[model samples]
Target: MLTHFERSLVEALRPLPDHRLTAIVEVARLSPPERREVFDKFGNAGYPILYQEHFANLRDIGPWLFCSGKYTSLQGQYNFHHGLSKATGDTPISWLTSALEPSRLARHLGEAATASGPDGSTHLLRFYNEQAFPILHSRQDLPGIDHLLVPIHSWWLRDAELDRDDGEKGWRRYEGKDRADCCGVPPIHLDQACWDALTGDGSSQRLADLLGSLPGAPAIESYYPNWLAQVRSLLAKGRRLGLKQQADLDEFVLFLSLHANPLRGSAKLEAAFNAAFKDAVDGNQPLAQALKQRLPPRLLTSQSNV
Candidate 1:
């Protein structure tokens, strides 16, 4: 029953890990009726196999999600922008129908009633029997699929914005509006820089350039000591922060240690930080002294202060 493309996709996905392959298989096996059930319930309007391919490709190569243009509708509009905005809202009566029906609603209402305490039982039962069950029973069966595909929508890519012309026509459309009067400022509306970076031609190449520059440009070695110095300076000034701030700083340090150095793991970084703090507190040395002792000497020596 598989088409050539579908067969090829399955072959391609076969070599992936068991979990990924299972996901692909589950998506691909969705019968037409099953897919229709999903569309009717969720307003998602894509072939399951297409979504499966998108997911598989995204897993293998990170940027495939953006490049696939699966986000684009048949009309060339962004699917989320055009399609999702047009989706009908569920009626209030549908809620009650779903509650009384032998569907996801009954389970949900039961959970809500339990969470609400003894007084909620009557109200919840009334809502379910009168509202949810009838609407749910009237509809066809829902999909058994584990995951739902939700498209990312943006206003910048809306048909109106993309169709804009320059000069005379554009000026006439804007007439009395100043730069401040508009929702967005200046010539190209929206965050032009970020928009171009995301949706522009050769977006994949731009992403590649970004990834390639990460390791060499910032020079992680240089960044680590400066971060440590800021923490040391704060400690030296006897300025205490709230628990959340302290936890955030601790997490930031762990992130820097894990990512900045290819050889280090969370456990190694944790040990280093633990040893440094122990030395600082027990020996009456400054936090900076403990850092210098535990961290790479080259990084500390080059930084001069902390």
Candidate 2:
């Protein structure tokens, strides 16, 4: 269950203000210790502080702070895979355990090397089934998250091609140029294009549909589905309280994080709640106040109405 500190953090997050919520993005851009300090106050005894950033707009890069201390190695092993599994689906192709398998990396390394781009950066082409592919986005260290050392990778760049738009007639233009001059090239800002190809303007619902079919495939854990379901259920409840978007998960989690302590509500749900909120509630004072107001009054459940 949740220790006192985790419980405290949750309370602080429950009634998040929009201004403070935006402040979260700013705080996320802070120094590691400073950022973690925000969540350190709310986590239960075991609660770990964590920050996550998306790369190639495809994967969530996390610098997680759990009780034992930060471990970049574990994060590296899970980085791209974790984000994809959560956003897409957890299947054998995107399986966490499978990715961690030493053999998997060894087998893929040769292919990873051959696929290097002109910039000397190698592409990680993950083959799921036979027709789909994944690619790497970019590399940068985000401190407020984990002291993470993992590079972000995405799965959709395998088929991406850039077509040069009509070039302005000039010395820079090579000879006679028409739209034909436009040909296959990948953008330096691969992340944005990958995002559009996957979730935005030219987004493929077919891909989303494919990912949906993968949840219970071989090697996928039974619990993940239940976990996701529970998250959606709580999220739906939070929507009734005015949380309607993906960001609402933060406010909902903040609420639970506050009452997560024994002093506020059910230890079971509080424990469960802390697992979900983690780094999202950065122990800011506004969050602390919100919990004081939004937490439900503690009551015994006798199934009294029934």
Each prediction's Cα lDDT score? 0.26, 0.26
Worst lDDT 10-window in candidate 2: 17-26
> At residue 250, what lDDT does model 1 achieve?
36
Can you write out model 2's per-residue Cα lDDT over 1-306, one digit (the tens) per residue? 533322322333233211010000122333565445434531221211121121223221221211211222433323322332232221222111111112222222212212233344644332221122221211211111111112112111111111123421111000111122122222222233232321223113322232234434323243233223223334433433333334434345334322334535466555444443332344332322343333343411111110
- The candidate that wins on TM-score is 1
TM-score of each: 0.22, 0.17
Clashes of 2: 24
Give lDDT for model 2: 0.26
lDDT score, candidate 2, position 137: 19
RMSD of each: 22.7, 24.9
